[model samples]
Target: MSEVPLPYRVTRVRPETADTVSVALAPAGEESLAPFMPGQFAMVYAFGVGEIPVSVSGIGDHELEHTVRSVGAVSAALCALRPGGRIGLRGPFGTGWELGRAAGRDLLVVAGGIGLAPLRPLVTAALAAPHAYGRLNLLVGARTPDDLPYAGQVHAWSASHGPPYCQVTVDRPAPAWRGRVGVVTTLLNGAAFAPGNTTAFVCGPEVMIRVTARELVHRGLAPHRIRVSLERNMRCATGHCGHCQLGGVLLCRDGPVIGWDRAESLLSAREL
Candidate 1:
């Protein structure tokens, strides 16, 4: 398919957190947007304005979804549009969190704030095929209770079966909230997994990814077994633009989903 943006009609919009909204899209064609793997992102365009890369927040047997935050001119424009609006989309780009590596092994997923959007599909896919992986875990953290995205779903996952064993934390908690309080890394202390057999997937702020990966390593997960979705780096969702370049890595092509061993040096030296 062409990297040029494809026309997509907004089918529905649902506010996630205060600043985030989940928009469902359907391409203006018989082909529709291509099926995307978890952790892959699409370059979403708001007509008349520019475009930005947004992660796929939710996906199932039907709708294509994007959980976008109105943080900039183009993104805000994309968010303000209503359900009947039209947008442009390209990609399903970047390397996705290849969950097959974790098959028959422990899988740990960690997210921070909106970072959970890209990781949600991984969770849904894992749950649908429970016997494929040894254990499933999800840990998420946000600035505050009100900042947590997908709150209801998180609650459901936490209350579900043995694997997935979900845990959520907030930097600060509202008096009305009764969940754990602290940065996401704090939850790692109570995480139950044999580090040696664990394949960990982390997506969050640069600092959080570092801290969490270090914690996972301290507990025994090998660097190669750790996968991370880098911040949605892009200009051209295809690698030609170089705007999202990090030394030898072109985030749009080489990653977005990069192994800790492959990215540790770059994440350490640069402003990823």
Candidate 2:
């Protein structure tokens, strides 16, 4: 394997949604950064605030962008950084959404709140290769309408991308809103899922994953067909620090994306 790149300088920052901002980084002495899989995350090191893991929100031929929300200390620091500020980056690590398996089958994506960050890459990758799958449905749930990530892009994708569907739900709706007003699961009630031939990618909080996984299984999806992206404290991307250990599995290495059956024991364990 090649050595990971070091810190890069922030070249530009753009806001995607109300609470989310996309940061563009330029590698030292270079105009571009390495390409990464859609769902991989980079270990970002913010000066004086320590390091944290953030998912890559978008990638271009020349710039690497990350869509981040102000949820914790590191994120808050990231939100406060000005353009031209320097920050360290380690990876593009972890297993990503299994795009190959999604080929020729219906693809259902369920994302909650900032969980949309990881899924955004998978969506972009799939859309770029339109014929790789059958019908594609994206059901997103946020705290409110303003909390939805990539709102404009989601609308555009729904409009021009085949029969692709995008539905958004919010726990609280604005007065002028016409979309669903409830948990994301509520939006799944009447939707059709071809479990036998479909694959589902779910990323969100633990509670959301639990509920979503149960519903998918109830809808006849095999345990192995449901892939989830899990989050935990990670000190190293290479599984050296032991911060992301879950039973015999080290989330940093074994997966951030894991099949339901493979995660059964870990997810069921009391302390994991």
Candidate 3:
């Protein structure tokens, strides 16, 4: 992961929600950074504005995608970018979801709101190779129907008729919404998987991750088989900055994705 950002041009810009946009980028010059893994993040520089760590939502040959929510200055700048715009990008940083470990085991994916962005590629990979894994289940939740990103893509995934078994819920429902309504964990009751044979991937608010992982453990899944993605005030993608430290681990360098066996105590610390 180079500290310096490389020039990239926006190839496509699509609005996902009122405050979110998915931007596709390609190398502007000959040089191209190494491919990013599913759960890894890139430091995206919006010209004079500044840079922020954005997870890679999709990855292809010499191409990348980022789903940005307009939460702050840097994110808002990214959301406003147009198709022909230019930006700077660096990295393939931090640990990835490591899907290979789950081979031959059932796959469970849980996401809350924008957390789905980083896990998107993992789901796509699993779907494409149905024979490589056991049953696949995806549970997603958002504040409201409109708050959900990749709504159409998720709908298509669920409509595919089998295997993936996608389900969605909303904390607050709109008048036109007709799906389930509740926190993400509420949907787990219907997910089909044998606890002993399952490997789960979870990403969301810290509280949601904690609750989901604990529930899975209570239902007989081993803590070591559950993986979670975490985020903090990560200023530098390298370990030099202590901003993203949780307990003794630096999220940007050592994590962002870790097994529940290792993350449980760190997340439960009273003075992290």
User: Which numbered prediction scores highest in TM-score against the true structure?
Assistant: 3
Prediction 1 TM-score vs. true: 0.96
Q: Which ten residues in a row have the lowest lDDT in candidate 3?
A: 155-164
Clash total of candidate 3: 0
> How well does candidate 3 match the true structure in TM-score terms?
0.97
Q: lDDT per model, in order?
A: 0.86, 0.80, 0.91
Collision count for each candidate, in order: 1, 0, 0
Candidate 2 on 12-81: residue-level lDDT in tens?
A: 9877666578788778565444577877788888887888888787777756778788888888788776
Which candidate leads in lDDT? 3
Q: Model 3 segments beyond 4 Å from truth?
A: none
Q: Quick one: RMSD of model 2?
A: 2.3
lDDT of 1 by residue, 1-272 (tens): 54678888889998888888889988767666678999888899888889898889877655689988889999899779788899988877888899987889988999999889999999988988999998788999999988888888897777776567999999988999888989998888777888888999999988999888888888888998999988644788777877888778888888889999888888888655
> Over 4 Å off in model 2, which ranges?
1-5, 16-19, 31-34, 157-163
- List where candidate 1 sits over 4 angstroms from the true fold: 270-272
In Å, residue 178's CA in model 2 sits off its true spot by 1.3
Clashing residue pairs, candidate 3?
none
Question: What is the Cα-based lDDT of residue 67 in candidate 3?
Answer: 92
- As for lDDT, the candidate ahead, 1 or 3, is 3
